[model samples]
Target: MKSLLLSVSITASLLLSPLVSAKDITPIQKKQLTEISGLLRDNPELINPLHSNLKQYLDGQKSLETILKTNHDYLYNNPQQPYFGAENPKLTIINFTDYNCPYCKRLESGLVGVIKKYPEIRVVNVLLPFQQRMIPGLKTNTAWYALNVWENDHSKFAEVHRLMMAKPSRHDSSSIMKIAELTKTQKDLTPNQKKMALVEKNEQIFSQLGLRGTPSLIIGNEIIPGFIPQEDLEKMIAKQL
Candidate 1:
């Protein structure tokens, strides 16, 4: 027993050795980080930082193991999952995004390639309900108008979303006009007065979610705030497959 214990200790130390980074990471490590982020909900200890006294299921589990047991809410009540990938494929990715978020735009840039890699994957998006609240005043109203149009006609939403992301302005008139042309909701869109009213309604739903910022993500069961590495996400998704 004594001999066996000594051998295991040696193995653990070697594996846990510090991961050195010159600029703090190698190109490969940097890349791995992108795809390695996973939902570790089932492994309760992960949430230990947030929840004290949580039991550890780690049991010498490697720092990076395919997390098999994320909370059901992570999968069931996901903010995004634009489509379904439950059974069709194991690689499913959801981005909980706001149109105005810079990080969300950054993530969007990498999304096209990720989708191409896994044809069977489902990349659903959960519209962050309160995205417009970041901007104040009439701009907020215009923001709501855009969202309403997208929600009312989802088929053309992807285009509208891209248009909103293209520019830096938040709920401005020029932006609204551009989106209107793309979605062509000019006549059907709520009048300016109605748009303002609509935004107020949307703000309530956002507040209820407890979302504090834009570009927040519900990757698997992992709640990653702001910009994240795509490679780490890729690895997490690949394991499921």
Candidate 2:
């Protein structure tokens, strides 16, 4: 009986581990476990298998928690990235996007609405520019140049960003030059190696975060991949909060 009780307790602890600290089990799960404990006391033979299953569940939960926390911290405090929103925000959403992605363009309105609705939401935009690879002969230089322009003159970054977002289909050098001229964004005649390095770093970060596409948002510990409606976005934020 004592051994059976130990197994039951171990199983209960694993099930409840993700949602609370080891020292603090919630009342509902505690109550439910207590009831299960009484029944499990008669079935001592089941303890070993149940213990193994419980260990697996706890291990998976720990892995996921570690990932979320690591990602959140990486996105939140990375001084090298560009983000615009709440100052000293309570909620940070890391946004991976490409200027040439239509889905990212589509998501812009809803993302803007989220920031307006929640004064504490910070949207960190990480330029993955994977779309550049699709264009024949382009070496993903647009985003690299954009980042360079942003560093040179932050006050003009928004105008440059808007132009790039507006002209996703245009891959012609002249068209890019036109947009750059309009925003006074083309400072370097050649590919600025440092900015391209930053882009590479961001791409590595995107891959490390297990993202395959654009318009992926990291809200709290959760990653909302692809285009999501404003209502769904709100619900996700509410859940995290």
Against the true structure, whose TM-score is highest?
A: 2
Q: Write the per-residue lDDT of candidate 2 for residues 1-241, one digit (tens) a residue.
A: 6676566657676546666654656677678777776676777666777677678767766776666676555567876567778879888888888887889988877888988888788888888668764334444366776677667777887777777777647455776777777877666324667877778877876776667888898876566789999899999887777
For all candidates in order, the CA lDDT equals 0.51, 0.73
Tens digits of per-residue lDDT, candidate 1, 35-61, equal: 322322343443334222111223323
User: Where's the lowest-lDDT run of ten residues in candidate 2?
Assistant: 133-142
Model 1: lDDT of residue 240: 53
Give per-model CA RMSD: 11.7, 6.3
Q: What value does the lDDT take at residue 193 in candidate 1?
A: 59
TM-score of 1: 0.53
Model 2 residue runs over 4 Å out of place are: 1-74, 134-140, 168-171
Q: After superposition, how far is residue 96 of candidate 2 from its true place, in Å?
A: 1.0
